[model samples]
Each structure stands twice: as structure tokens, then as C-alpha cells.
Target: MIPAGSGGRNRPIEHASFYAALPLIDDFERLSDTANFTALPEDWLIGVSDIEGSTAEIAKGRYKAVNMVGAAVISAQMNAMDGQPFPFVFGGDGATFAIWPEQARAAADAMRAVQRWALDEYGITLRAALVPVRDIRAAGLRIAVARYRVSDGVDYAMFHGGGASWAEQALKDGIYGFDPAPSGVRPDLTGLSCRWAPQSARNDMILSLVVVPVPGASARLYAQVAAEIVTLAQTLDRGGHPVPRDGPAMQWPPEGVALEARAQRRSGTLLRQRAGILFQTFMAWLLTRTGWTVGGFDARRYNRAVAGNSDFRKWDDGLKMTLDCDNETSKRIEALLAHYHDRGILRYGLHRQDSAIMTCIVPSIMRNDHIHFVDGAAGGYTAAATAMKVQG
Candidate 1:
């Protein structure tokens, strides 16, 4: 059982709607402001999941599969929680989420199910850990959360303090880790899809970035750096959104059809699932090509929402973004980061590619609020994170 408090600190009053109760900040730049964050209840648990050896997987050109597995963690947990609002952030190689202790069993089942599914479907190992917020506090780190409203109907969680990063390290170091479920366990990955084709960079390049303050660096310094970087990115077209306003182009056979088939294969055989996916995608492609609305489903409107709902920028203990920009803009952003790196203020990594990909969790296409996670096509956050480690 997880403790309610640690180190003589009083347990926080439990708010059933703790996450929903926090005010939403509309401005992305304001994320750097620590004042906007709320301390999570000590009894809440932080769950971290990541693809083991994700960097090597990216080198093998399996980035799409890598991304699919990461997004699966969120989709499974959300389905398990029955859409009750909670907070989660999607990293290209994995994801992190927080949950109340009451939901621990469901969250754990979902995590184990995803771990097994990833291995069974794609030969990938997903490492997961559920660490208590009290444990994080005991380690002298904090878990502060803020909600950033991306659109009228969608808000992504932004994490502050180093607890999240610490949880990931602990998972990697074999602490607080758990084993995958027995064979044949399947996560309820309803609505997880990767049907859209990769969006080619409209500008000269698609840049993937990871910027984190060095250990013991003051929060004020990190916030100033983050704000400056956000400002620089804002100067780009559509704020460096890789997807076009109309959404990504739809090819007849999407590059992710097979992966989506695997995700949808809960009850049906793989062959049946693949065939169904093929037929459905065929209709979607035709509708998108013809610009038609059938059964109250507008392909154009859905596509527009896809563009607007993409998680192209977010903060998770640090700043992470996938931007489409010209060469000069990329150079300028890097130079600024290099100046800070030279001064030992931070550590950063960047990867440039020609296009970006979107992995989605669409509960309902008619809802106009489905979310899409974006990452650089060749090597997104996983590669950038590896580069950051290499610089040390």
C-alpha cells in the first residue's frame, strides 16, 4: 500500500477532480511560470512507460512502431479509466501519467497489458513503473502539474519539477519496475490509430528538440530559457506546426495500416482485422480526396481538427517540441541553446528530418476534439534524448 504522506508532511486534502480543478493556461509561454502549477496529492502515483532500447530501434528505421507502442500506453489507460479526466504527456518513445491511488489497480493492469501487447505485436519491450508521489517527495523532488488548453475541447498536461524525470531514471535503473503480464493479455487500445501519412516539412526541415536544465539549476533560470525558446519557435509559420492546416495528406494505404490493425485486434483475428482496416481506410481516403461529408462526418473538418489538436509542443520536466522551420530559424534556435549550454546552464539535443508523423487516439471522429501526437519521422524525441546523453 502506498503511504498518504512522507517525512512528517501533512497529506493534502484529496480532490476527486484534482486535475480538472486546476485553471487552464491558454498561453504556451506561460508554462514556464511555475506559479501556474499545482502540487499533486502525496498519495497520487506517477506511472512511467518507455520502450526499452528505443534509440537502437530508431536506428533500425522502426520509429513508427516505436511511436505506436508509446501512444498505446495512454490510450489503454484512458480507456481503463472510462474517460475520467487525468493528466498524461506523450513522449515519442513512451509516455508518463499520474493517477489517484484508488485507480492504481486499473492503471497497473493497463500498463501490464500494454507491455505484453507491445511485445506480442511488435517484438518491443515496454518498461513501466508506478512510483508514489510520496516516494518522489522522499527523494527530495516534487511533481507539480499544470493543464495547457490546446483547443476549446482539448487540454494536455504539462509537468513541472523533476519528479517525472526522476521516475523515468528509476525505471531505467531497475527500481520500482514491474514485469509484463502473462501471454495473451491485451490492453483496451480502443481509438488508437496511425492512419495519416507523414507530413512533409513545409519549411526547410523538421526539427525535434529536448531541452532540460542541468541538475541543481534554479527553476527561474530554466523558465527564462524555456520562455525564450518558446518565443523563438512562435516566430515560425503556424508556430512551427509540421502538419498543414488542412491536415496531413491521406494516401490509399496509409503507412501505419498494419500497426493500426494490430491495435484494433482485440477480439478479431489479425487477418480479419487487417481486411477491415483496409476497407475502412479506403473509404476514408476516397472521402478525403473527394471532399465529401458522409453520415455527418466531414473529412475536411476532421482533418482540420487533426492539425489543430496535434501535440507538437509540450513541457515534461523540460521543453520538448517538433517544429517545421527554415534552416535559418533552426540555426538561430540552436545558437541560443548553445550559448546556454556553454555556460553550463542546461543540456540540449536536436535532430533534424524532412517530415513528421502523427499517431492519434480518436475516441470519436465526430467529436472534433481527438488528439494527435507528432514526432519527427526519421528520429524524433528518442534520438534527440540520446544526443543529449551523448553530449555529457
Candidate 2:
């Protein structure tokens, strides 16, 4: 007997034999069926994502940037999904997905990847609204689909919303995904987006809420707006920041180049120059060893993506961003925060004080404050495997 939730051609035949009583439909039937009332399975992965702060980003009339971010995220999502029996709706400011229950976690993870891609690539924050199949349905869809019966375990193309056209009418009535207002949180990307917190949010899909368009803005400009939005992305949603120190780092290779030059000139700027190299080295080490892979980052093919300088770090050394930060460090911290501001991670904050690292991938959680990682569970950091005794 074929078990439930099996995929890749082994699903239908097994499901057919198991749930004989529940009318089964073939992939073709499910796809072409004109009926609406389809009894879905216990598991459902309803995924959705939106721009968190678009209004301010688009202030410079950079709609293309917004679309670029959206395109990247959606394309990434499509790749992650790899064709499931669900529907994807590009609802202007945001998107929605209706999928099988088993794929909820996978969908959530994919959505997160998409958001991170937007952040690391275009410096935008994508708010995700993931839910199960059984929760939060458009009344229109419910009314439209309640008439037909569907076969379980069969592949089907079941999408309801698409683009501006489908959502045009619904958007006006405030029924696209969910209401954006009333939460008191205004999005950087305003109009043409919304989200709602579904009531059945806990029944399935690991128990969560639907993160629809809950007041945000979109990327309007592309080139010039890049720096502006980049700063906002960091300031608004960003948290942990890299702490820096004064004087050349303790690990600069070409001591003569920076140090000798500093000694000769007796200038703090020269020492600062050496610090930049150390910072770059640290970033390189972390990228290679750690799992934190940069999206728009390319050392070999380093283009304007990581930096406007496609010409081999031609940009000002001081403008370069540094990560793998420390808090005790001050000068470097200020420099790093300046970099974050330039990248749209930090807003109008003062001198570097804390880490800019975020707590979770979720934008809302990240906005509160610094999500510094601690060693004990009492804090955000990890807990000791087991309690220890005092040496005395």
C-alpha cells in the first residue's frame, strides 16, 4: 500500500487505493475540472510574501527597483516550489500561495530564502505571511470553488489570484490577502498591498499566522534609489551591527603598506586605511567558513551589486561595509554602521553602539531592537548543554 503524502508519481495510485471512499481525481481531472468544491488534504502550505518598507524606498520614484525585488523573490519562490499542486498569486504589492499541507514548512523556508535574497541582493525586507491550506480563504474563492469535488493525491494546478487584473477588483474592497491598516504599522511600500492574520492559523502548518500585505512600500527607483532604500532597509528592519576598533586591526598582512605609510605620514587616515583591509579579510574569512553566503556578493566577478564598483574595489575604502562584528569595538562599529546606513540597513541612528544583526528572518521581530546572540537561553543566545559548577 502506498503511504499518504508521497510525491513524484507514487502519490496518485497509492492515494487512490487508500481513500477509495473519498472521490479521487486525476491530475488532468483536477486541473481541468470546472468544479470548485475540492476536498483538500489535512496538510496545506499557504504561503505569501510582501515588501515591509516600500513607501520610503520608492520616494524617489523608483518603481522599477520595487519590481526588481519582487521579480527576484517570486522567481526564487518558483524555483523552490518546483511545481506543486497549488496556486501562486502575484497580488501587486505581495504574493499568495495555496499548497498541500505537507509542504508548509518547505514553503515557509523557501519564502524566507526569497526574503533573504531580496535583502542581501537589493537590500529590501520581504515580510512573509505563511499559513496552511485550510486557513484564510478569499470569500470570492470560497464561493467560486464550493461547487466542485476534487480527487485527493492527484496533481493539480489550483491557483486563484494572478496579477493586477485579478486583484484589481478585490483590492479595492480590501479582500486581497488581508487588511493592511488597523495594525498601526505602516509599510515602506504602501498601496497595492495588504495582509491578514487568519483565525485557523494554528490548526496546521506548524501553527503560524498569515503574513500578507500588512502596510509596506515598494522599490521604485533602481540606480540612484539603491543607496537610499539600502539605508532604510538596514535602519528599519536591521538590528545587530558589527563592532569596530580604532587603529589598524590586529591582523593586517602588509604591515609596511598601511603601518609603514602611517608611520611615515603620521596620519590616522593611513591607519584607518589598514583597518579597511583587515575588515575585508575578516569578511572573507567568515563568508568562506560560515554558512552566511552573500547573494549579490561576488569577489571574482564583484560588480556594482556588492558595490557600485565593478572595477575591483575602486570605490572608497571607507565606504565598504564590514560584518562578523564585535560590540566592544567602537571605531570599526561606527564605520560598520555607516556602511549599514549606506546599504539601507541602518536608518538615522547615531554613533555605533550595538550589533545590527537581526534576531529572526521575520521583519516584524527584527524591528524591535538588536537581536544579539547570547550564550545562555535566558538571553537570545544559546544555552549551555548542561549547567556547570564553580571552580572554587
Candidate 3:
């Protein structure tokens, strides 16, 4: 949803390059096999992880990308076992394998252990966080197992944690990994359901979430979230933000977002932080006004928040990114739109975490540069429609 050229013909050359010079990372591709994205694992504890700031973290620190990946791999295998006797697999950065659930817990414990090792061992600023399919916990992380069946594949539970993911999002923000995507795809975040708030971004009723669904349990919650998007479109249409609806195909803009099958303003960004930060910031601001601050965030509170925050929490789930996405690729494209917009002037192209062709893009929106827009998104977009303005 671009403003059609922040600097039209009247803009200068450098201003014109503001977008043209925008850095673009490799296209993010998530889920390829025509097989349905399901979960079918037999007595396997799946730990999903990805090297977040491996590039920068390595450059600034001593750890390399491979080191980070290896750490995640080792951690996944450890957590899956949970000290039990079973086999395990570390599916790269976004995932890992475990021999037993007991070993899996060990992996989660290693989150702090590994980071401490990185910091102490190699002078690297790396962190690891793990989760379990059942009974998972970490100091400041969200843990959930998404149970899904992929096409003919058996059921498998994907362990989701927050620290590494948050780091991944951060690394992505340092670059522009999301761009060049058409606004038709919508990815299902239900797989990444159990959520938590970043200690740095905590505010009122909102907690930064990891957001991986319990695999098969995302249907109702997904639908519930979709409802919130509908209401949002109605509100935007009334607010004069050009809700260009194309047709009966995609549910964007409610009426004017999709023009003849083309998305009017492409949206969706890895700027989960941008949206997260913006809204969370507002939450902090609002709650502060009313004496509200994030509580301890019990496990049940975290799970329920992901499933039933209504609009309050549901809205934070990045629902619009799924506007017209009927499959995975399209969803990536739409998500790219968000990835781009949220990046703002300082684009951050963070490729989809699970894409085969991994890449990242982030533009630096200097703090000293944009005074009025400091609280805005990274690139130049803001997903917080109501949060900032609703500060009563």
C-alpha cells in the first residue's frame, strides 16, 4: 500500500532513488511441495529454528552463520530428546530434530546456555530459545508445538520458540529482505501460534508473540482472526485510506484494495517488529496512561492471547498478509508487501524464515532523520492503525 510515490515528479533525484535504491533481498519461498502443509511425525519432537542475526551477529561478534546454524541444529536435536530415548533431526535454522522429548527439553534449556556460550566462548552475540510439543517454558520466550499433517505425510509437531525468531526478525530489519511481492498471497501464521511479548516491547495487554499455531488447531482461530481483518478494512475505508477492492476474489480493502485482480497497495513485511513495535509501543503508551503494564505472562495467558485476543491480540497476528493468499507462494508475495511497507524508508528485506532461497533486506531509518515518524515502521509503513490513535 504505497503512497504512489512519496516523491512524485516534483521530487529530487536522490528522493526518487529513495525507492529505486531500496535494497532487495532474495525472494522468500516458504513450503514448496504441492502436498498440503500438514504435520505427520511419528514419535518425533520437532524443534524449529533459523539463524536470525547470523550475518550481522557474526560480523559484529565472532560467530559465523554456519556456527549459528550449527548451534541451532545442535540445540534442536537436544530439545527434541528431552533426555528421553528417541531419534531427532535439526532441520536447519527454522527447525531441528530430537531423539526424545526429554532431549528436547534439554534443547530449550540450552537456549540460554548456548547464548552464554556464544558470548563467552566466541565473543558472539547469539541467543537460542527452544520449545516443546508439550510442556515447554523459557525465561522470556513463547513455546508451542504446531501439530500438522502435510498431504500424505504423518502428523508432526513443530516446536516454536521466540528468542531466536525475534533475533531473526531483528537481523531481517537490518536489511530489506521483503520486497517485489505482489499483494495477493497470504501466509497462514496459525502454524507459528504460541506467542509471547519481547521484554523490551511489552505493554498493557499486548505481548510480542511468537505466533505458531498448534498445527491442526488453527481453523477456528484463523477464522476468528479473519473476521478482525474485515472489520479493519471497514474502518480504513471510512478513514479515507483508499480501500481499493478489486473483486470477489481477494478480501482486501473490502472494496477498492484489489483493482482488477491487482493489489492497490502491496503490504505485509517481516516488519512483524514494525507492526509489533508500533502497536506494542502504543500499548505501552496507552497502558502507561491508565496504569497498565505487561504482567508476568503465564503460559495459559500466552496461548489464549494467540487464540482469543479477539481484535486486541488477534489483530497483532498479521492477518491482512493473508488477504488473497490461497496457497503458499502467493502468501509469501503478499507477506512481501507487508515486509516492504513496514520496512519504511530504511527498507529491511528479511526473507521468509522457511524459504528455500533465503535472503534479507533492511534499510536504516536513522533515528535522527525522521523525528515525527520515529514511532513509525522501519521501512516507512505502520501496521498500527488503532493503537497509536486510540490512546485515550
Candidate 4:
């Protein structure tokens, strides 16, 4: 969610103007409709960040930390821009975003800060890069973007044209990238947190899926496949939202308390940050458990907002989703994906787990617009991606 007043009103009109001018698409299914996406300006830059060995980290039961660091990239850039509007998509282990030329320096600095923080705090190496849209075009690709409004004051970006995927590949190939800052450096991870316990799957399984068209596949075929999957998911409750209607269960001394403390450590000593987070979360746990409202913060309303504003599904040059469904529905999705995979129309990956995890950026608890990112508690997109690579 773009923070209010951070729409670049004080900057040059050209800065982030393209994303700001586009009309928000209310239906998630329309994300597959090519008519809704607008080509991004050639001068804009795409920033990508990911942990170097995310799969290994997840295997070590550190998926929460991996998700936190991935979301930190978006958080840092948002804070750096002072909450200005931009288009970004959060992958389970990484994130991709676009910014105009005027914000490149700030974006780069923020990226560097996150890189350092990830290494120092979690011993994870974060790879980051900034690729120009013109360079993407030079490589025979384009970046097209559309905003999908998930709730009031909350919109998640849907990407098409494959530019984001190419930029990520370029980053991995050691092109157009930068190194991490020295030890002790940290980004402004002001609102990043993973407070709620993992949401157990009510439907027997939490399925993480990623589907992408092959290099020569027709766009029509890909869109048809994506639309069909979206339709299939719609048959389930709340389109397969993993979190319950009231929200995921809250626990005292949250699972990610240490991570949350690290995120806020810039404000004071680590111990102090940890203590502060503990106090705040304890209060939240007590309030949510008792269904109480205190001075603009309605526990029940905020919980519902958390579930409503989550990013369970998104398009980033391809379709990705974390769904809660029974084994039968999961089989139907796999069958559909397999039918197309055999014909070379698309390739896909699916991973199943008992629960899903959420990482949030709450600019203010009193505001219902806070955004949450969801992924399967076990491996999520990183494992799905690995499985996809094996398909080839």
C-alpha cells in the first residue's frame, strides 16, 4: 500500500507519474486481460533483490527470516521514497519494483542498506540490482504494469511483458548489480514485521503455485491458462485465502520477535528494540484475544483488514499464488497445469504444506490499509521455482 501523501506531489510530475495515472483494476481476473496493462516508460528502472541461497535457508526452517528479508527490500525503498507511490511485487524470497530516474540514487542506497542488514542480522547474503527499462528493451523485452486494488487504499501491482523476469536473470548472471554495505549498516525497515503465527491450512493443504509461459508460447494460450487457474481458485472459499476471516492466530512472544527487533534496531539498542517489540506485541495479543478496541485500534476490524489486504495471488510477468484447498482441488489445478505443460504452452511448479506465513508492513495499526504478504510456510515460491526449473 502506498502511504498517503507519498505520491510524489512535491517532485517533478514525471516521477512515478505513469503508475499514478493508471486506473486501478478491481477484478483480480482482469490481470490476465492484456488491455488493462500499460507499458512502463523506458527511462524507469527495475530493482530486484533476493537471498542467495533461499532454498537452503527454508530447508533449515528459516523461511520466516527469508520472507522478512525479501519484504525488507520493498519496505526500505518505500521508506526511502517517503511513501511515494510505485509498483512492486513481493516474491516469497525476493521482490521486484520500478522507479523513475529521479529516485534511482535513493533506491540504490536503500538496496545497499538491505543487503548489509540481511547479512549482518541473519547471515544471509542478499543479491540486489537496478536495471533500466531501456536496457530491458534493448534486450528485446518490455515492462508493462497494472494496479489491482485489493481493498480500499490498498493496491498490488500486476506485471506483464516479461521484463521483470529478465531483469532477475540478469542480476543472477552478475550483470548490472552492486555489493552490500559494510557491516552494521541497516535500512529503514520501520514497519516490517512477522508477528502472527503461521496460519494452519483449513483445507488440508497450503499450495504454492507458479506458472509461466515458455519462450515461444503464445500470449493468448498463457492468458487462457492463467484465467482458467484463477477461475478454479474462485470455486474455493475466499478464493483460497489461508488466513481465517478474523485473521491468523496471534501468540505472545511472536515467532518472529527477534526478526522484528532486528528490523527496528536502528532506533535503539538491539535489546531495547526487542523489549519494545515484546511489549507492543504482548498488548496486541491480549487485545486480539479479548476482542477489545482501544483508541482507534479495533482488534477485530484490524484482524479482518489483515486478512483482506493480503497478497495471496499476483502476476509478475507470470502468475503466482498461495492457495488453501483440499487435495481434490489441488489435483484439479495440477491436471490443468500438466495438460498445458505437455503441449509446451506453459511450465509450472507446485508445493504443498500444512500452513502459510505472512509478513506485514503496517504503516499504522489504526489504518486499515496495511499490506500483508503471504507464502507457504514450507519453502513457498522458492521451492516451487526450483521444481519449475527441474521441469525443463
TM-score of each: 0.95, 0.30, 0.26, 0.98
lDDT (Cα, tens digit) per residue for candidate 4, span 104-206: 9989999999999999889999999999999999989878999999889699988899899999999998987889977777799888988989999999899
Candidate 3: which stretches are off by over 4 Å?
1-55, 58-109, 116-123, 128-144, 151-392
- Could you arrange the candidates by lDDT from highest to lowest? 4, 1, 2, 3
Writing each residue's lDDT as its tens digit, candidate 2 over 264-339 gives 2223565675565456555644543453656644322221111110010000101122222233332333455445
Q: Which ten residues in a row have the lowest lDDT in candidate 1?
A: 1-10
Error of 3 at 160 (Å): 9.3
lDDT of 2 at 216: 21
lDDT scores in order: 0.88, 0.30, 0.26, 0.90
Off by over 4 Å in 4: 6-10
Best by lDDT: 4
Candidate 1 runs further than 4 Å off: 1-15
Error of 2 at 168 (Å): 15
Model 2 has how many clashing residue pairs? 53
lDDT of 4: 0.90
lDDT of 1 at 191: 91
TM-score of 2: 0.30
